[model samples]
Target: MPRRVAMILALLLCSGCSSELRNIELQRVAKDWSLVIRASQIIPVYPLTEDLQPGDTFLVQRPIDKQHELYDERGFLPLENLIHRVNPRGYQAFYENSLGLGGDAQPIPKRWLTNQQPWTQAPIASFPTYSFSVRSGSGFSLALPVQGVPIGLSLLGSDAAQGTITIADARTYGVDTVSLAKDVEDWAAQQRGFLRNYASTGAHPNYLRVVSRVYLAGRLNVSLQSSDSSGATASGGAPKPVELVTTAGGPGPQDASLEAYKSNLAKLNELIEKSLEKTPTGSGQALLPGGTVKVVAASARAISLVETFSRPLVVGYLGFDMLIGPGGTLGPPIPTYAVLTAQLEPHPATVALELLDTAGLRHTYEVLTKLGRRGDTRAADLVKQLDGLGTLVPRQYPCNMFHFGDAAGPLSIQHPAGTALPDQKGFVRITLYLGKLQSSIDDLERAQADKSLKIATFDTRDAAVDAYLAGELAASRTALRDMYRSLQAHGDLLAQAQEHATQATRKLLLE
Candidate 1:
């Protein structure tokens, strides 16, 4: 007897007659095999949203203007090309003068600084750098090695003798220093712009200014120092200063005057212990990498949309933007955004095969059995069927849909069905250069008081290596140039480093 078929009766109910059932059936095949899938990351773009909501969900689908005319503003390919060139990172600076100002001050952590260079050894760490500060009449200026990047500085201060402090240079000290806290806020705003504008493509803004302020010296006065255009003596261009104190806050960190410590140091110890638990680094995790993944063109949008929906089970049909390299023993680096990743979570194909008989889908059932019939000897053919089946439909439908997987590109479907797909001519995946995040967080926690100092140190070192790679001649030349600049002025350094790293890494692109 011939093999029997399995049937599924799907029913629809109505008001009058008894519900009619459509009995759908599929033939039973002799052999069976399972399937598996893997994909790296699928960043979604706005084209996927058919409808818009309010709030975060609405913002997710909100249409971004295509007006930037990347090709016009910066020729299409060059702007696209420059994106891979910039590797941006941000560091926060916290300092104090004899006046005793206490609070946190972060640089503008703009989005442009988020891209990871193809050559960057590891993904960017999302955490902020913590530091301490000390200010006096003749302020101290000390520069340290940052992974060797040339970093500039901006000081937020207030003098006790002077009623109010003033910050004159908006270029180094951003434009919006209306308030002490404004610096932090404006910095964040700039970061968002970098993510949305410059980093995605090569649309470089004219300038990135620092936000700054001046506090009157007393309990906690702080102010920004102005840089001289001529690059002369400290006093020739120097602004008058005030008192100072700088420290990375300690466990159970608490502020007290000498008078508070006149008698017992025991109470001070307990207070310090309490503060440790509340410090930013107390939990031992860093901030998530901050940046945006933009899909500028229609083709980029379609690719991202398809891959996102086909995730887990549909590895062959994705366009992954980034992948965190596996760690030595600690697992993969913590991804900047989990939901936006392409890493296979629950393999979809394998799951679908496990439910072959239970799925009640004829096409799925047929695919499973056909590849299993010839056993192990024909495994290669089966693998091709499971993976690169460019054309499998019957002669009657000669120009039907075809599927192809690209471990290096996007998994895509094409038709003799081409209109809906994006133009592949200018297609390229631009990966930014961001060095691996620091290996440990212990140092960051310890240097919390000198927030600006520590960040500046890292920027100086990172930029130095970047400058050397960019062919800036001497290492000392790069270091000296960085000495005069502050971490607050490192936008160009990060961008240049990214450019070099991307060029070096492109040689490793998958075939």
Candidate 2:
């Protein structure tokens, strides 16, 4: 038998026990349901920024009057300028210095450095913001500037393609040495590695954290597009390409050594690669880059990139922000997790009424019997009138049922059994039930003044309400039934009270 049924049977068999014992048993059963309901409602918390120090526990509390929707925002830093093209002589010097092997690598003069710059800086200021919309299981367009060059973009949810990154515009701006398409694909793969590591070592396994990190990290220069267009674009005309310049003086022992520059460049590349590899990928197949970059005029620098995810996101906001470190280098990207609560339509009034009836029926019956035993006919009739009030009240259930976003699993139990009304209505019903029950108990107290009797009655009602709020309708229902059975077992006490009242009536008649 289910534990619920077993507990019911045990309570019925022990009906002859004192009311105190029955209340204790009912509380025990109510606790079991409370645990389950509480577990389902718990939402895990995550760090919003990478700079969170140890021993800090962030907890978000709900409003006392109303509920608010949750929004999650994560920021992704851009890649720092690192890779630079070099001639055979410059390459040899960089290679030897990087490996720490002593060799006479001739340093290219500062005059040559100005003309032979490897990477051209794209004017990022031209496009300050890109407006885009992403629907669940749909694709959207994105336009962003990389190294100051504008690149057009498109994105598809996981429903379309899995783990694929396709680049549309691939023009070489400066010396045209690095493959932008190949680098993007490699970067996607590295991001997938980061996700895998987080899943393995994160304090808690959160799907939102994994999905958001990968999606934000894969695309560079992402930012939430604003609905309004004001201030969206920079005031200046198209930004001109800027050349990479080193501040080091002319070539000499006093000048900045080529060996030192190469070593620093290698370190920057290593750090960038490490950051890329640790970022997570979108849900779907692993991302593979295979598209070609279209080299067009510098004026027509539009690259349309398409990325497909595994699942659709109802993204209220999607975009990236730049965090520039010292020397204009991008800082490390941090993971962010968002918790959303969806508003659901109210359930039928019958659902809540059914729960109230199931949990309150026994209590109702007990109150009626006690009133009858105490010879309080008026109180008994008033208590009986409450039975029809359910019909007079509105049938709409009021509590707002909530669930997490698509990343998390669906809500545990939409509506628990026993007419689980929303919080407000449930509390109202509990108050009415307690009021009527207390009226009968008060009359009994005036007649006999038994403290134990009042304690037993209050204890049972309190336990039932506690169970109901926790979504343990069945337990609350059973608790009420136990209270009824305890009252029925008090037949001898009721008989004595009735006889006393009858004798008093006879004495009044004789007078």
Candidate 3:
């Protein structure tokens, strides 16, 4: 295994540093997805450039607001720059390396190194401002240079195939080649390892961490060109020569389209309320009110009712397993599973305002539910403001339905047996009958086919005599051999499968 890993690494290195690399150009791929890169150093200035204060909060990627969107002018830092690329381990190393300047280096503030913040709160910036004076230092200033040497390569592809890299300027008291090389090499190794693993798993190798998709494809060109302005474009315009190996994976979609699912989920909320308050027909499972319900259908018809009717029903959770036949026929409709575990309840704070005003209670509940369901905390203040209006108003209602996402697996249950709704009974019975008959027919067909083959084969002792018996003898011997081999193979496979099952069971039990 070690040898194989080494061989793989060697091959990767060869490809990474081949003579073909000289022509490879530094290119930037445009993507809707964001990329983050982190920095390896922070140099302090005698006086801060923008604002030099004692303690002013600075963060990247503040909490998302109610609309499932970032607050205005606020965004998660793109993975494009070094500051966003560095990981925690990298940060620790950078800090330690920077501090290694001994007595010559200024000490970093302790608070900046701590992870003491809420999950929703952003990480504190490496650089912060203080409003007041310090004991020895009245004010200190620092600025991230707009021109600093880039220590990393950006993978690019296709039409956006070529681009240039430039250094961002900042104070350089803390910059060192050794420190930068170590950080950049470590980051490059990480990216390469990840790409290799992704390739081995049949995934697109160019998919960056967090982006979950490839921004570029094929070979890239890298070169160096100088801009007319020496100070502004000296290091950059001339693209540094480098090579990158990218891989592609099978086209796979996101786990689920959250946006599309959310709309249908909202409609189901009303249906859930209606079902909970009343009794269902036969199954006695509390079903949402005023929607057409039907039994499992055989084949494609089953897939349809599930995909279509699911929108009207407000079960806490639902899974629509669609089976398409040879030519896209919907097969074997199964409700799989549907249940109402938690409904989105109105925030008491938001509802309280409605009681005081009465006119907007319904609208307030609706809006608050929408905001809460999307992980938007921006609504918190609005909800709190409403609650403060009066003590007489109710503060909570059933609106935040978290159970919808929490449900696991397909909802597999066929219930409310027999007939209940007389008006709809005939059609329900017919659909049920067809489904049952189709399933039965398929089963019978399989059994008959099995029996037919069994009868056609039997043990034959004769060889030349078996040759005289010819085709029948050959078939008999072949069947027996196949059966014996199958039994032996099954035992080995079963043993291996049992071992895996045992380990999984232990993990679950221990956890």
Best by lDDT: 2
Return the number of clashes found in candidate 2: 24
The alpha-carbon lDDT assigned to residue 44 of candidate 3 equals: 19
The local lDDT score (0 to 100) that residue 177 gets in candidate 1 is 18
Per-residue C-alpha lDDT of model 3 across residues 481-500, encoded as one tens digit per residue: 23222322333332332233
Model 2 residue runs over 4 Å out of place are: 1-66, 69-303, 310-359, 372-378, 382-511
Question: Against the true structure, whose TM-score is highest?
Answer: 2
TM-score for each candidate, following the candidate numbering = 0.15, 0.20, 0.15
lDDT per residue (tens digit) for residues 77-106 in model 2: 112222221122222333343432213443
Q: What is the C-alpha local distance difference test score of each model?
A: 0.20, 0.27, 0.23
The CA lDDT at 280 in model 3 is 38
Off by over 4 Å in 3: 1-217, 222-425, 441-511
Q: Please say which candidate is ahead in lDDT: 1 or 2.
A: 2
| Candidate 2 positional error at 76, Å | 20
Write model 1 residue lDDT over 1-511, tens digit each, in one string. 0111000000001111222211110000000000101111221111112111100000111111221232122211111111211111222222223212223332221221232321121112111121222122122221111100000111112111111111111111111112322322222222333333322122211111111211110011122232232221111111112111223335553534443333223342233223222323456633322111111111100111000111011001111111111110001111212312323331111112111111122223233334335352333343333232212211221221222233221212233322232221110100000000010111222233232332321344355534432331122222222221222133233233333334433533643
